[model samples]
Target: MMSGFCRTPFKYQIMKKITLILVTLFVFGCKPTEKAVETKLNYQSQVAVKGDWQVTDVSYANSDYIKVSLFDLGNTKCFVNSTWHFISNNNKGSMKINDYSCAYESDITWYINQNNEMVIKFLNGTKSKKVTTGYVVQYVPINENKFQLIEQADVLNKTQDIVLTFERI
Candidate 1:
């Protein structure tokens, strides 16, 4: 009778098992989670908004309110082409009107209010002649390239909330 015992083979087998288990654990742990991705998306939206953006669409929160196009408001050209440049660090920004006749730029201050609302203030009389300052828009992080914002205004002495869709430029 003869018997053979090899320490190397046994050790190798045990090491292989440990490695396989560790790899399985790591793979599972590294898998992307939906919640984590959503959180990251929210953060990216916040930073991406700190740059230039243009209004693409506009609508009122309530369907009862009338919808008006840039031209419908007596604008010769598209007023939705307006641009807003939000400074990166400083709480400052600028709004540019590009509707031909209303073409003008204004120095503005912006902040993410306590309610996470985007509040814009037209400073130094930069606001449009017919507009007023303190326009607060609720910030809705839709994605990296686009976001939705809503703000209430006294359009006709009645407070109405308007939703604006913006696209990064």
Candidate 2:
């Protein structure tokens, strides 16, 4: 009878340990997992501007200012009639300048951000990520076949809009 009594307490102790472990596992297993939320890129404007486009015109709200260089490539006149090709699927494109003695071409990566800004990076044989400098312009769509890239420029200490009109080809 004494030996049985000792064994019963030992069994109870083992049972208590097993129950504690099971309860711990149950509590931890039922916990909700945390997941990282990723921001989805807006593709509406991307789809609307996808295709071949030509710079039909470049105009400034205040035209009394001096010659302005655009994107450090050349004068604003150089970009007029330039060709731009946008590939929405890969967010890559190219700009070709065949006017105003500014004969130049470059591979570019572009994307429309959540703020409706067109961000462009000119890659001159360098990786897209390696190029730190970029240009941001407000993207304004006039219609399916036409759009405007408005860049704010400081002219005589005043902010002015330099609009570049594009037409689909």
Candidate 3:
């Protein structure tokens, strides 16, 4: 009787181990491993956008009715003529607003994600990991020398894109 009790527990231990192994294998095996598809345009856009750029224009659909403050910095007009330096090697850059009243500069880290959106974060002298707030904008490349960062804003109770056109410098 004693031997039978010990044998039963041994059998249960083996069964538990088997069940655990199977569950782990099933869980891991079912996990999706497909990588995100990287399009040619993504690579080309990154290449096209890299280097020094100047914001030549900033326009919105209905600017006359709605006034927008961009990046919590200043008016959209302040961004015009701003200089942006995009270093592709580490995807780090700086933005300098040269508009007389809004003269400011900040360190930024940016990247073109798999979705073709340009994600940017203003470090503002802080570490990138410490900064949680960031911005994502539609990245449109007209040519190697020209690109647009389109950001959506609430204008007159509707969503509108504030387009910032950039030309390579």
The deviation in Å at residue 29 for candidate 3 is: 27
Kindly provide the TM-score of model 3 when superposed on the true structure, using C-alpha atoms. 0.73
Which stretches in model 1 have alpha-carbon errors above 4 Å? 1-46, 61-78, 125-133, 155-158
lDDT of 2 at 161: 86
Instruction: Give the clashing residue pairs of candidate 2, or none.
Output: none
- Alpha-carbon error at 39 in model 2, in Å? 8.0
Clashes, model 2: 0
What are the models' TM-scores? 0.55, 0.73, 0.73
How many clashes in each structure?
A: 0, 0, 0
Q: Quick one: ranking by lDDT, best first?
A: 2, 3, 1
lDDT against the true structure, each candidate: 0.65, 0.88, 0.86
TM-score-wise, the better of 1 and 2 is 2
Clashing pairs in 3: none
Error of 1 at 114 (Å): 3.8
Give the worst 10-residue stretch by lDDT in candidate 3: 35-44
Which 10 consecutive positions of candidate 1 have the poorest summed lDDT? 35-44
